[model samples]
Target: MQVSREEILHIADLADLNIEEEKIDKYLLNLQDILNFANIVNKQDVSNLEITIGSNEAKNVFRKDEVKVFENTESLLENAPKKEQNMFKIPKVIN
Candidate 1:
């Protein structure tokens, strides 16, 4: 597949990208290479293969959940730079 400079410019405009004039040719060549590689992959024969979405093997691999004692609040908050009423205080992140 051939990707032209005009097509690249149109795609950039649609995607809100500001591609410099000097880089347009390189971008067009790279896009064409990617399309060519995709074409090659599309021609591969996989008609007899089973459709597997994930790994074929499964294993039991989860830790058992149980109640456990944690350190006191004062000890837990000792490393925090800011704390208020046994809770860690962080800078406001949302408007």
Candidate 2:
């Protein structure tokens, strides 16, 4: 579509912009190109493509939680700086 210089200036004025006199022609041509590309995209045929809500159709993909006993409890707590009841004894955080 052809964009006029007056229309460009009017849009700029509405947007509270102060466009330079020399750049109006450049802006007019750029706006016209963008509108022409949009028209081309609007006229495309997409009847055979599947409609997607997002990039993929993945849902909740998590493994079931199960408790298991460790064989070597002494080795796991060997490097603990403080151990009281067969476990790593950390400083009490909450009052």
Candidate 1 regions with alpha-carbon error over 4 angstroms:
45-95
lDDT of 1 by residue, 6-25 (tens): 88889999999999989888
In candidate 2, position 50 carries an lDDT of 73
How high a TM-score does candidate 1 get? 0.45
Q: Name the 10 consecutive residues with the lowest summed lDDT in model 1.
A: 51-60
Please list the C-alpha lDDT of all candidates, in the order they appear: 0.85, 0.86
Colliding residue pairs in candidate 1: none
Worst 10 residues of 2 by lDDT: 51-60
| Per-candidate RMSD, Å | 7.9, 16.1
